[model samples]
Target chain A: MVFICSVATAQLPINWIDPLNEGVLQGRLADNDITGYNRLPDSVKSVVREPVWALGTNNAGVYVNFKTNAKEIQVRYTVSGALDMPHMPKTGVSGLDLYASNNNGEWYWTPGDYRFKDTITYSFGPVKENSHRIYRLYLPLYNTVTWMEIGVSSDATIEFQKEEESPIIIYGTSIAQGGCASRPGLAWSNLLGRALNTPVINLGFSGNGRLEKPIIDLIANTPSRVIILDCLPNLTGVTPENTERIDSLIQAAVYQLRASQPNTPIVLTDHSSGFNKNILDETDNTLYEQTTQAGLASFEKLKQAGVKNLYHLRNADIALDINSTVDYAHPNDFGMVKISDAYQRLIEQFLR
Target chain B: MVFICSVATAQLPINWIDPLNEGVLQGRLADNDITGYNRLPDSVKSVVREPVWALGTNNAGVYVNFKTNAKEIQVRYTVSGALDMPHMPKTGVSGLDLYASNNNGEWYWTPGDYRFKDTITYSFGPVKENSHRIYRLYLPLYNTVTWMEIGVSSDATIEFQKEEESPIIIYGTSIAQGGCASRPGLAWSNLLGRALNTPVINLGFSGNGRLEKPIIDLIANTPSRVIILDCLPNLTGVTPENTERIDSLIQAAVYQLRASQPNTPIVLTDHSSGFNKNILDETDNTLYEQTTQAGLASFEKLKQAGVKNLYHLRNADIALDINSTVDYAHPNDFGMVKISDAYQRLIEQFLR
Candidate 1:
């Protein structure tokens, strides 16, 4: 825990890669929407707000792997716009967040402000400087990446590690997309990726994770070791009036994934109570009850229909106590970590 | 921690107040700024974004005294607008957050979903419902409190408590105003207010806490047990180029406060490092260095000039770990709590 007051900034030669470039991206898609590789569908994209659509474009679940001999490293990138909102901190705007790890499989933010914006460049020596194991760095979670590159000492050996061909994929709400987190790497999905020691895919659509047919098609088509659907909060939307819609959405998504990737285990998660119902608004109470009930009922229906390789996670399992959420709906970093605790364990069973 | 599954909605009499109403407010000023009783000045009000100014109007540092013998209570409030932003959560948007404590001076949110929205109400039982005690509730942080009221069971008693006269006053930036806190009560300022067992004043103007003369005039005029100027982070921006402005702001603020209230101790806090300078963006690093240097230099100037009742807090006092912020600047709940921890200690000195 010794913090040096001042340290010399190392001079080094570096290799850089533009992740949005063809053949360079791995894990998640950068250009899934119709607007020439934007993250959201041009239609559904308009349905959401500006900040959300902008956040959806961030390479949250995406990562880059490069092996370098030199201990010191630097990363640089730019965002489309560093639009500063009064309510949100600048870090969540266009901040180029970084996360790295050695062979030990533990991830840490390079020493500095994990959230930055306007222009992005972070340089730091690895914890194990001498060993040149593969390192992973996640991009922003709440802004669009216009350009990014990696740097290392000129003479150091540098190579990009191959992407994980079969990775665990999580499809859910903003928590899955990394909402209000200080940086991209802190999201539950990304944390699970680091913990499980496997590549993971994040197809989380902020405010639009309603298990639409279009989204399920995309998730089912992806090469995944396991598929997780944690969209109950976004699905029920404070009402059970449309019981058929709730039942059909999950039922259809489950069958679609099974039809495409029959061997890959698909897990459905019930609504995680973001607030204590004991002291909540009537709407929130209704939302909690309807969403969880709908999720459980749909899970039962799927089980009765002999859906193989299917599992269910109850809402109460996570047990996030009071004040864990950033808002009632979004989990803070601690809550996100707690969420990863559940996912890391849930997927392990299928992997074994 | 006794778990009750569900209970019938109790039939009870209710009491409520719409603080925004001209005559109903207590504690906080309804028309401090020249902008027709709003918190912000008429000119500056137009300069800042809508949400920021809207948030300024919220009843922060404001409290309503109420006595109720009812076993259970409910608070209902509606925000001016429920504008949703992606980078921040709904709680930071239009959520109506509430806090209460019994005579022990321990503040707690009235049970369930502490964060609610649009027209939402939070209901909870008192620490002990047998007798009535003075209860205090803090309003929303990032939204305008348009309409609000309180409700109680039929047989219970209820009435408004009086405002404290000579309270602790905090003058600073968005962090002081509760930026990314999931709800109102979690903000460091509110937490400090509760922890100190007294009324506290909040003059935290989002991105606008730059130590302007008008703001200083307001602080000097207010009756306070102690004065805290934590505006360094918001004052210095990213450049120390003019160092004069930073120096002048502090020197002027201290002089004004001393002239107005010579007996009240004034506390100045250095910038809490939200980011590590070693790995921060060049601009952010420059901000850290300049702000710290300017703050220290001014503190020395004040001391040399025989400014009595003056105190300065070092940055190292608050140890905020990485990922503690929603963005690198404004802290999430954990970071806010950490900030409150330091203030709770620092101000305790002046109180004694």
Candidate 2:
């Protein structure tokens, strides 16, 4: 192994590698028609709603894996939208998050300093250790990666690592899409994937993850160890105005998935909101109450029908509080960790 | 009590009230020379370093307190700098964070939807209930507030609330200045203040909070319940290149404060970094180790000199980890909470 003695010499020749050519991309839906680093295949453009199609262009759950001995690494990529949302930081919306495993195989984040522009650049460490190590780079949670290239020192060796198979698949709303995590890696789904030592396919559509038949059909088609439905946030309303519609949507989604993958475990999660605790804000409290009750009722109905491997997770189990969210609707890194802990407790059994 | 019953109507006549006129602004260093919502008095502009003087213009610890019966409250304000930094969000840097105390005196965050532009606007609820309640609005943690106005409904009542006196004062660096909190209220100092039901004077100068005698003298002059020193991050380097300088700075700061206020509790916080746990990154580990050791040595030296009420807080107690930081240097909301817990535990006794 070659060791670069100093971090002071930052002018060392950098060798760029395309992650796609290296076969290091993970959490990408397997499709020949996928033209770039999009969450959905190009073929789905006509099949889904225009909003879903546009959001699909985001690189939400996508990541890349590789092994290298380079003391320092760099990434240059472009994002399609404004770098940030009003509540979310540019780091979570459009920047890269990197983690490396030590010799003991424990994963830890590699701190990076980044610059934002038409083409964003992130530089990660003069790590100072000469041993070859595995690295995972999580892509932007709420933005599209138009193109990306990884750079390593000229003398360092780099190789692609294969992804773990039979991923855990999550179909949910903006929270699942990593609405307001401080960084992409702090997203609950990514945290779960790392902790469980498995892969995850996040089908979290921002503001658009209603329990629709078309999306359910897509999820059923994907092979996975377990499937999670966390779309109650998008389906339930404040007054129970469409309780019947919500129940129908839930039943339809479950039935569709059961038809295609009868043995795969299905987990339904209730909406977790701190608004439920508010005594003064009736509207906020009502929304949380109606949504959670609707979700619980659907789980009970499905269980009575003798649906095997069906599970229910209460809102309380998810562990969200007023202090944990960014905009009272989305989880921050601390809330993400709590949600990840809840999922790991229930889903780790299936992964094992 | 008059209440506007509808949120649908956006054209309700608003009664704009200047917080300065109502005597509601808190956390400003007391001096007749102060002109606006700056943390430091204008008298220090020519006394400190240019960068230190400039950072003092930021409204890091400043907040507004009032009791309002308005169903909805709105703020229109202008900030002096760009809305955000690379790792931090605009919400924490430039947006206002609001909290309301319920009838039982328990404080809870009042969620607000915001629009960012030349004059940033934030709207907080047509809160269905119409009781007069106390509200605290935390200002931007990393931006200078040029001008601000709070608007309530024409028929509503708004009254100024006096701030708690003898605040716990913290003199430190970027973390103490609230670098990467998702919102202004989540800053460790803000969180501690709210939790303790006390006021906080945050004398945190971003990138320039070295323990210089000029700033220490300013802090010494300020009457406080407890004084905390968290400037080790700004003073320490990757290597022990300036160990003697760090020691002298700490000794001088402590001596200067002791000379003025002999009995007030002085707490010194060590640098908290997850890099200390990394097995592969020697540069990161070295930086963490050397800084932490330097801080501990100073604390030991001070204690050996029979300095009464001089306390030292270990780096481990700060509760930061790899997952807690945004860019490894600045703590996110999660890390901020942890650090707040540590400070609350250490300082609560003196406060009581």
Q: Could you say which candidate leads in lDDT?
A: 2
Instruction: Kindly list the per-residue Cα lDDT of model 2 for residues B1-352, writing each as its tens digit.
Output: 1255454555668999777666667876673677678777777777889999888889998988888878788999998888987777889889898886665667767778899899999989757654646788999999999989999989888887877588788898999999889899899999988888888888888999898777887788888788999998887675556788888898999999999999889999888674455433456667766887888898999999999998877777886776888987788888988899988887766656
Tell me the lDDT of model 1 at A289: 67
Q: Residue A328 of candidate 1: its Cα lDDT?
A: 49
Residue B183, model 2: Cα distance from true site in angstroms: 0.7
Local error of candidate 1 at residue A73 (angstroms):
15
DockQ-based class of model 1: incorrect
The C-alpha stretches of model 2 lying farther than 4 A from their native spots are A1-12, A102-105, A128-132, A239-241, A278-281, A349-351, B1-12, B102-105, B128-132, B238-241, B279-281, B349-351
Q: Each candidate's iRMS in angstroms?
A: 7.1, 2.4
Residue B304 C-alpha lDDT in model 1 = 98
Distance (Å) between predicted and true CA of A38, model 2? 1.1
lDDT per residue as tens, model 1, B1-352 = 1334333443544655444443334435334443322455565565566654665675555556666676666778666644434345455545444555556554434444433544676665543552434666666666666567777765766666666467777888878877767566677887777777766778787777777776677667777888889888777654455578888888888998999999899989887763463232345556766787888899999999999989887777776655566445667776777788798888787676
Q: Give the per-residue lDDT digits (tens) of candidate 1, residues A1-352.
A: 1344334454444656555553445456433544422455565564565654665576667666666676666777777754433323344444544555566665544543332545666665543443535666666665677777676667776666766468788888876877656456677787788788887878787666788776676677676888999888777655456666788888989999999998999989877763453333345556776778877888999999899999887667675644456544666665677788887777787787
